[model samples]
Target: MTKKLLKSASRCIAALALTGAAGPTWAVESVKIAGFTWPGYGFWHIAAEKGLAPDLDIQYQTIEDPYESFNLVAAGQLDVVSSTAEFTPVGVERGLPVKLVAFGNLSYGTDKIVAGPGIETAADLAGKEVAVLEGGLAQIYVAMWLEQNGAAYDSVTYRNIIADDAFAAMIGGGVAASEFWEPYGTNTLKALEGASVLAQSKDPYWLQSGVIADGHYMSDALINDRRDVALLTMKAMYDAIAWWKQNPDEGNRIIAGGMSMSLADVELVIGKNGTGLDGGLYVYDFMEAAQFCGSAPGNPPFDQKNGQINDHWNLVSGWWVKFNLIEAAAPPETGIDCSLHKELYDSGYRG
Candidate 1:
């Protein structure tokens, strides 16, 4: 057995040996997690601060580069990572031993395709350089917009730039357009003359697509060797979301404090209002996500059909293939492990 499995067995034996005595004392499992500094990914901070999973030592590292986070997970340096939902297929195609275990939240209107001055339409961007975090959801979003607007997917040259750099490129007139989220998207519009949003994620097409979203990924080792820890970690995430629903102010404060972001900036993504989608993201509660994953029996909110995770996975895989990010599409089951959601639902976890 793996070291983690042996350790778990030992812990169980110890707990059984202590039956009918004082409360069993077991060693806390140390779960290392990483994510970029985004408000949507900050829920892990809430899970930590609130002590939702007391049995697990949640160590969350803020690594701005999500690709690095995935690298760490593949290298056995991290257990879980919260990141954009669309990368699982890419990871699978690259032979990374990482799988997306749960869908966290959806972008309501936080993500935008912003065009710089003199770029009036999709056709205008042809032969021009557009900025995006190449091999990411931003690239897919922009490509989708282009195709929908009668332009070929490869019409524009893609500059593989991060959002912050993309913002600067927009202001400096270095690129015709870029994909951005939250403060950067809004700020680009404010900073550049004639800059306008070409498309927002909250639109019916984008919402139904569910492409712009966040999720939790776990290394194959964690899911296979430390199943209990994986389940507990996933539950703790929902527990944090439940607490946030009840205490939005405190939760937002905690998120902002942990992320070193302004409260206003955090609110712009997560929202101050009690409604989850009032801000920029539609934070999925446990049950709603279960529905999306087809672990439960009902349609997800926003008119999304149940079991849409399969569709979303295939859709992203198709885009990755088109962009040459992956040679071919892998089966959705290879990248997504919805059994965690199913287990949680079977255990009567409603939120």
Candidate 2:
């Protein structure tokens, strides 16, 4: 029999052997989960590859776009998605019935504002045309950078385009600068002679606030009907993190193959001890996540605070509202849920 069928059979036998009480003490529930093509999100693939949640039936897919993934969740075609946390407010405002269940990683230096040759500082960006992925994290990064650098929000021209297009624009001299992440930043610096990064999210000001973290969210339907499955799914994610910690090299290979990214690129994102890509992104382990979501009591080391997810959401959601990315900032109670991580941790889910 297939694994699902075998699991079902075992559960049925156990229930019958126990006098068929018809209680809530059954086996796992089938879950449908998806996420974009990012290293942090790819950890779910680790769960699948290692059979971490053998009792639960998990269906994971790769959906490149966050909006599309949430749309699927809204239509009941998907149960959960690992995506950028900035979209939580937008999803709530649009009535998507999704919740930010847990955070994944903090973009240490992945996102950047790259300037072409002859632009040395943030002030140089004044009056110059800059490209960004409008209505996405790029816009938010650039906006926050400009504001922090004593530059006016409208000091420069904003060209909204896709990341690849923005890269092309910067290379062709169509725009003086653009927001880029990962290989894109590496590519821009290599392709354009004398190009440099003016600002990045890794700085203490940005990193300490947890403004650019990735997240895993579940649909209301799944959280309501299959709460146990939701808990099991999260437990699998934590298990994957623990496994990756003890086996970084092998884990990177699995993630690279599963996400269709090069091993080198995967290393760039995962970085040793959260210092990858010259401080690109800081990968959060299960313990760190528990503290971040306020599910774990007390603050562990590593500059993280308990219950910071809601605070971070408030900061980013306010920015979204100010930039008109969403209609309004949604309350934390509407979407943020840290209790899931806490419950698993308390239950001794070290993995």
Candidate 3:
């Protein structure tokens, strides 16, 4: 389930915390986190492998859906979560008390719209059905792309299929075309015959220059109350990213094993995304990372330097409120706490 409604994430987080198995040690309160099977979350895989978290023990569980992840972190069952852009706003709106610590990756050319043999153009999809993980970021992007191309969202019959599930159905002719997030999108393109690129998040026509797909997030309570841990984790994350750059093949292998995909397929997915295991800005220089993930004018989804929310994030929040995606009574921007990332970035810790 791309955005499949599941109840296991938080439950798992709570269970892990209670078990206190974040690591083999207990001095600093090891952090337990649940991430999905994407390139971005593999940072933990890299970190844990390198023993970067000597004082910290972070247990990593790769959940497949974002919906479950938000509630898990919000419930304090999990210390951190890496979520997509749409889900974060939903979390905030529902008053889950989540915070946007840093973006996992801005969707460059990663997320894609692939069409099976018969379809050639977006216009050809006017009367045809297209598969998209219902209520997911892919659905939103596909709908928006159709709208931008002089068509209504209703132009195509939208299917409520997850990326992997959609791949199966697409092979069976359940839908002529579909849009899905990366790795899956890349996988679909390779599995299907004669598939053509209908669109990708990296396309310039995409709103926000395709910086709309936020790949990760965390909990505000944890960030505010247990900040020392957050900084240590961030530093470990940076180290992991650096290690990933020097070891893409190994990192991809580990990620592939975790995600249940073939090593070759994982390579393709990472290649498509352009970053793979070390899949982020890297903040190669800690001095710059503070600014990149900080509350400065350059900070994403908000202009901390300019005293405004990152335009991209604010746009998503406003869109949710305008479209009523959250509960009818929910405030779109209510749950997000950007200052958490800002504070973390500014508090003397470089990475």
Candidate 4:
């Protein structure tokens, strides 16, 4: 290729990029994202290492806890985040400006309300102690499930506990029943021989239909603030998810390493309740999610009829209001902004 011809081709590509030809334009600056300490965000690591985001700069930071991680993103220090569906509303209330872009994975059968061998059924849990992280999605889900089954949710003792300490409490037999997600749930059941699933949060009940799973979140300000770059990042993430779906063995290995678990353990986690470990990214038609969530008010940011999950937020928020965790009436609505995801969807940018 002669220098002149090469230069001509480069100019054509540049002109096309500048004119928004072929696909959505990409931002030229580097993108910094705050990711949680979990395997769901492993795709970013893989995509970055594989040079998937060659056109856009990608930076990853480890946020050991979700609370601090989302807070930072809301503060505009980070661009992207990952967490369950239960958090979008919370983010909105806290002024985070985060939006659900794509889903990663739901708990499937990973989360559970389990009791030591003695407390067999949900009915038996009345008056028994149940350990859980207070004010989290898990607690509310457990409560709702109990209520649905005619169990006395208030009758059970609720203990506020963190994830790290949850295992110890369950194993040492400090709590009769406990609500938790995997691999902690797996570890607890394994460590306690007498433990039995009082209620499993399997699909279609506890964590599905766009309700309980790991979803990709991006800042609305980042997209509207930097449109070209946000679109490109979405393309890059789609590539990452498609890449993993095609290579589960390798993908599992990477995610397992990221999660500090053995590959077999990762496999077990994915295998929770027959859930398929398909590639984590989805490139749905722009209006598809609106159909899914009923958010299609005007082509973008379609209706997210996620009352099931939203109810959890209100329940917890009310508890907080009652317990003084937050102000009585101010719900955190600023934290979640779906406009960016809605824009990409409405723009028909699948890449």
Q: What are the Cα lDDT values of the candidates?
A: 0.91, 0.81, 0.64, 0.63
Model 2 per-residue lDDT tens digits across residues 174-203: 999998888788899999999998988777
Q: Give a tens-digit lDDT track for model 1, residues 1-351.
A: 699999999998887787746656668999999998899878889999999999999998899888999999888999999999999888987899999988899999999999987887899999999999898899999999999999999999999986788889889989989999999999999999899999999999888878899998999999999999999999999899999999999999999999999999999999997477789999999999999999999999888999999999999999988988889998899999999999989998887
Worst 10 residues of 2 by lDDT: 271-280
Residue 7 error for model 4, in Å? 12
Model 2 pairs whose backbones collide: 109-280, 238-351, 239-351, 271-276
Candidate 1 vs candidate 3: which has greater lDDT?
1
Q: Whose lDDT is higher: candidate 1's or candidate 4's?
A: 1
After superposing candidate 3, which stretches have Cα over 4 Å from the reference?
1-26, 190-194, 205-208, 257-260, 272-309, 321-323, 327-333, 340-350
Please report how far candidate 3 places residue 5 from its true position, in Å: 60
True-vs-predicted CA distance for residue 179, candidate 3, Å: 0.8
Residue 239, model 2: Cα distance from true site in angstroms:
0.4
The global Cα lDDT (0 to 1) of model 4 is 0.63
Which runs in model 4 stand beyond 4 Å of their true positions? Answer: 1-28, 207-210, 271-336, 346-351
Prediction 1 global C-alpha lDDT? 0.91
What count of clashes does model 2 give?
4
Sorted on TM-score, highest at the top, how do the candidates line up?
A: 1, 2, 3, 4
